[model samples]
Target: MKKVIKIAGILFVLLLCAAYFLPAVQSYSHIPGEIYILKGSSKTIDLGLPVKADVDSSGVVNISGETLEKGALMQSPLVIKPLNYGKATIELSIFGIPVKTVRVNVTESLTVIPGGQSIGVALDTRGALVVGITGVQVSDGKVENPAREAGMLPGDVIIRANGIEIQNAKQLMKIINETQGTLALKLDRNGRTIDIFVNPVHDPSDGKMRLGVWVRDNTAGVGTLTFIIPDTRQYGGLGHAITDLDTGSVLSVREGEIYFSEVIQINKGESGIPGEIKGFFSNSSGHMGNIEKNTEFGIYGKVFDDVDLSAFGEPIQVASRDEIKTGPAQILSTVDNEGVKAFSCQILRLNDQREPEQKGIVLQITDKELLEKTGGIIQGMSGSPIIQNGKLVGAVTHVFVNDPSKGYGLYADFMLGMLD
Candidate 1:
């Protein structure tokens, strides 16, 4: 009888051990590695586990309710109060065992007017982008691919040739046509610099020297505007980077512009077929802003003084990732001749992202009007502002090709960080 009691005690201790460690393992995915809080403001976060938090720098931030009772299965709230504009680290532990460390940044609160108007983006790449490699016919009736022979790929950006910086496809062509022998070329391949020597072949058809490579220097498209900062007049749109359709490489911005556009047509989306919004904007007038940077997050620039701000309404508060929850939301977008309108949607999933990511929110369109108009989220709807609980939470990023009603969104906090 004593042996049986001893064995039962051992089993109970093992069960308690599993309960303690199970939440510790799950905390890694629920808590972010870094978080930003507004200065002088307090934020309460629930990690779904009872844990203790310790701050490394007391001057920057302070933690309230630092300890939670052990053996409690319910989620515990940790209140973070930012004291100043600086940085600090918070270490989370369970029963004196450290589980995760989160970097906390105290920054000034920012508010911006959410934009849903359709805008035209005209971006000129920093250098000519090679889109394709083909064979060049020589005078001897033989074909040679000089670009491939020189180890050049389709996605390579020819930045310099023969010690001259190349700005456009026409300029690169001029340099190749004038070159006599093997030309030294500098290329930007996936952010890495490489130098190669390529022998230009004289094409019998055009009677001009050719590298047997197709290059493009500019790209243009229509997209919804995300937000506009009132203080700096800076604007962010697209919610994601613009890539070349042929090479699938992110376009490096040299100079670009955004213009006011009007939605002329909308092709309804269908299963396996992504629709698009067609709009027209004049290059001479309707200028809204200048594109300064094209990053993985989106395109950012300063807006012109003449930009119409009355259409976007008043500026709204921006919500951090932790502040966002899965529930009903609304997205501001322009689909037809009418101006921006709010459409109902639902936040299906929210990802706890430690690093910057584009697809952090999975959402589904639920508005019967929107579902009937565009057949759900379509192309050119990217960067549509998502409003939840009266706060700007995120923007539309991408659509699930298989399901037109479902799409991905990016956190507004990540987009705002790019402004800094």
Candidate 2:
């Protein structure tokens, strides 16, 4: 009987060891967002927006900002957009593996105002919304016009003409105060370049000149790098469409342009706080690659300069969608000290088609270096190549909002197929 008891004790000890060291109990899941994958395959991804909702019974997963339920799922479709010329994470995912973000360009009409009651639109400083303005500024007052008698300044930029662009100061001042429902002129005075906006302000006496707010022409910051496809000498970036960030509208172009940027600055990030990459947008005409487009996948353009960008010997092959094993990997981006540095990462959680967001691939970081600067993957690193098993799997797409070290990537096959 004592011998039997000893054997039972030994068995218990072995079981304990197995429980302690073996891989985790394939638990609920990884990360913060709700999960929802394509009903069939993980290859099909969704890039749409999500709204708050109560958990439903079938095909539903609930996710919060910090905590997560392992092995559980909640949502569907992934939507991405870029902000500040792509410098900030308007929407990005970078925690573990490759990163991802989408760039949407908005084109707005220019509002010109001469003077008096205004007409036209003005773009919010962020470039998101363009609304009708009623005022603007008066420059180089005409001699015979009431503007001369009204004494409008030369450097004064307009905020609203009672608001819009006009032919000359004559059309202006002559129409002041006559405005009932309309007012114009919003402007700025920068050195010699005087700018005028058409927004309205209230004026009681003879109402000579009035402006509503301040405006600027310069746009700065970083953004994602979509793709660099080649047709002999040229390469294109952004596999999909370019839309306006503020309005969430796509841009139609005669011909798109590419620029070579040197990374002079970086902003390291943390949970709930994302970092950034800074570079100069140049018009120096990079090597002329090619430009092509597809409604489903978006656009494909080429880069000109053949320098180091094209020199990488072997390209990573796109593994079968079924072959993307969730594990170790790395990405090639322009974050290194020398530029376009390669960083380490881990495959934290993956989306199976049966799960929620079947939007290609998602990963988490295990690299300390990348975690130190720019969190995992910040803005301007999108489209960086994800190399695994000596194959080029996809490009970075989004960064996890709450976690800087983790993000998302898209299958290169999907993006490349669109180009062909």
Report, for all candidates in order, the number of backbone clashes: 0, 124
Q: Give residue 120's error in model 1 in angstroms.
A: 0.6
Clashing pairs in 1: none
Worst 10 residues of 2 by lDDT: 112-121
Best by lDDT: 1
Mind giving the per-residue lDDT tens digits that candidate 1 earns over 99-212? 788888888877999998899999999989999999988988899999999999999999999999989999999999899999999999999999999999988787899999
Model 1 spans with C-alpha error above 4 angstroms: 1-36, 44-53, 65-79, 92-95, 98-105
Report how far off residue 303 is in candidate 1 (Å).
0.5
Assess the local accuracy of residue 332 in candidate 2 as a C-alpha lDDT between 0 and 100.
68
